[model samples]
Target: MQDKINRWLLDNALAHHPDQQALLNDNEAIQAASACQGNDAEKLAVFADHLKVSSQLIAVIDDYRRCFDMARIVFWLVAFLVGASSAFALLTATANHVNLMSVTLFCALLPMFSLCLWLGVSLLRFGQSDSISGGMLGRLVNAATHLLSKLMIAANTAPSVHQNAVFRAGRQWVNPWQLSLLTHSSWLFFSLGALLGTLFRLSFYQYDFYWGSTLLDSQQIAVFVQISFALPAALAGIPLNADLIASAQLDQSSIQTDRAVWAQLLLMSIVVYGIVPRLAFIALSQVKLRQSLKNLPDNYAYPLFRQALKRIKSLSEQSQQPMLAPRYPLPADRAAHTGANTIASIGIELDQSDRWPLIKEDTVKDLGHLINSQQYQSALTALESLEKPVDVLAFCSYARSPDNTTLKRLRNIQDIAEGRVLIVLCEQAIAESHQVDIHSRLIDWQTRAHEHALALVDFDCSHKVNVNDVLNAAEREQQT
Candidate 1:
């Protein structure tokens, strides 16, 4: 997963170059990659391995990876320390007295507020396609990573313009949800650090806890304390009564001062308010981030990646085709000069049981079937030995499209014939249901014939072919 992202990022960076062919379209490399059996990501990984990505761009990617990892570590470490220091500073009481309201608010205030904001943003942005922006914490982490990446680049004495541009693009590909995941994890660490900090302060130090209020009486303060600390106190098994609350007031001198109950209430408050919510959001952020990564390629807006995918598909199709033997060239110098008007008939790749057209000429020579290389060579040899300017009739089935091998064979026959060659599309065996397919095949043959400057004459075995009439039709089609 780590290197896959890097390779894709590098490929995208290379695609933006003006000379794409020189940079990316290496024929042998493409063929090699296409030969591998796998999905797009696996094949693209092979392709990237074959291509020579620039060393500077490679360095930039490596640098980004290092900086991102380091920034994650540094961010969490800073968050933990900040949490610990804030807890330690607030818990340091003045004149051996701890204010209950100030202690509760200091531990719960920032984490609760930020958590509410995160929950609101998450609900509003759920299932949205945009990954460019995230919540406040996510934005802060992204900014920090970006700054660190720049510093890493600056430390290098000379960075290429190409590397700089690719760096900018690669950084933009960062998913905001991934940053949000990091943000949630950092908060989790902060909560853990605050918990440990609170335990350490309360375990080692002794202080009297009290509340002083100018506007409210002790009864009102008791009511407020009961309402606020009800859940935490219940979970901690600490009894909260009006007598205990009134005795903890500053004006009322208390002979009973066991601060253990107050410490338990504070720890429970930090856990319930700070730790558990961050943990839940961290899980939610992780799930969203994974989904975003899984759908990354599909959501890529660049045409170049799509083009590269298409190119891979085309190359794979080409690679899967069966290898074919080389086509033999036509016999050169087979022209005859005896001046006897003759007709030579040959069927290419046709069933031997199928009858050839009955030609009304004494000089007609049936050169058997030209199905394989040996048969083709023998027919060409016989035609070379002819003693007249012989016109050729080449027969092919109209049941299927003319493939490259079939076209090549026709071209070979045309080259060696003395007078002229006419393609006879034998359609007598075709059924009426395949008439539409036959018409399409005929159109394809006509286009191929036009390309090679050959002529065509439809042949039916039921009809007798007049040598002169067929010759005339072939000549007319060739001229047109």
Candidate 2:
């Protein structure tokens, strides 16, 4: 969890945000830290006392956790679904051999060989990051992250530009080692399944296993066997004699040999080559992941943390009192006038079910994704066609944190609309919801919305609204 937090703070966009910028100064962080005067636990309490540090840190951690949880779920699902299928298919093919009386060592070991080849290629390509980005595994991971973001969203619509960028950027930084752990875990399940399948059949069925191969000398086959099984066979007190090699031919009844040696070699080969190495890689990846977390630089060096401290100090000093709550900007009253132009009720991360306020015969637009070209174009076209100074009422989900993404998106709307735009936050209607305190989450939204001088409102559960208030606010903005 701590490692994920470290990774989240590394996102480049955070540096571009005002909140993050304010948190970037070393001097400010040091000044904020001066309040701490005890052990680690007490120090953490002191750090929490500073407003910017806690909020920025929580947001980063939350962002990373959203994707991490999704990736991990996809990884385990692959382990069982892909692993079981591969093992079952190969094991069935092996068991269905018509000439079970003369099973060649190479034929029995084909599954392991293919598995090794796949791991080799994946590792090689893992080094070239872009090469794998569009590959099967990468696509699976991307889909998982996408789905994760969707499931976590309070609204069913696609996320904002900054939100999409955040997850897309995360894909590039998730280390190959972490992905390798997922691959190795799947391999372990696959190899064990195949080995167990073979063992199960062998225990119940009677069959003589001998070595055979076409286009290769029996002596050469024997030599290959010696190289592969020499150590395991030796450990098990088994020998590959020259006479045994000459006698071991393709299904010749007179050249029959004990099948026990072949079974030992096959089982040992599966254990030593397939299962052992994968387990080792999984362990190694774990160590590397933890080390990466520990190696993350201190928060004071981070721009986001620095900006957080800065925000806190500024708020305290400006008010001429200690900071109490997040400073918010209340909407200012504007000169009232009768309506003239269209009212565009754009939904920001909102689903279809959420109601938007109806303005007297005004244009209404529904956009699922703020950054996507199609949705953006549709909304822009509507605004362009409408008379100047359109009133854009944006309905957003109250469940999600009004992070930098929401701020940038709404600000962008303000840029293009050339009129009044109000953000209406809808309540969480779905049950079995998140445990985060509603008011606490609202604080984040209020702070961000206030930062941009945007109009904001929370949806009443009844979806009831004063028609006059809605119309008045729509008509209040000073025309550009």
Q: Candidate 2 residues 131-154, lDDT tens each?
A: 221223434665676667656643
lDDT of each: 0.67, 0.53
Q: Candidate 2: deviation at residue 246, Å?
A: 4.5
* Candidate 2 TM-score, true structure as reference: 0.49
- Steric clashes per prediction: 0, 7
Off by over 4 Å in 2: 2-162, 243-247, 255-257, 296-304, 314-480
- TM-scores of the candidates are 0.60, 0.49
Model 1 TM: 0.60
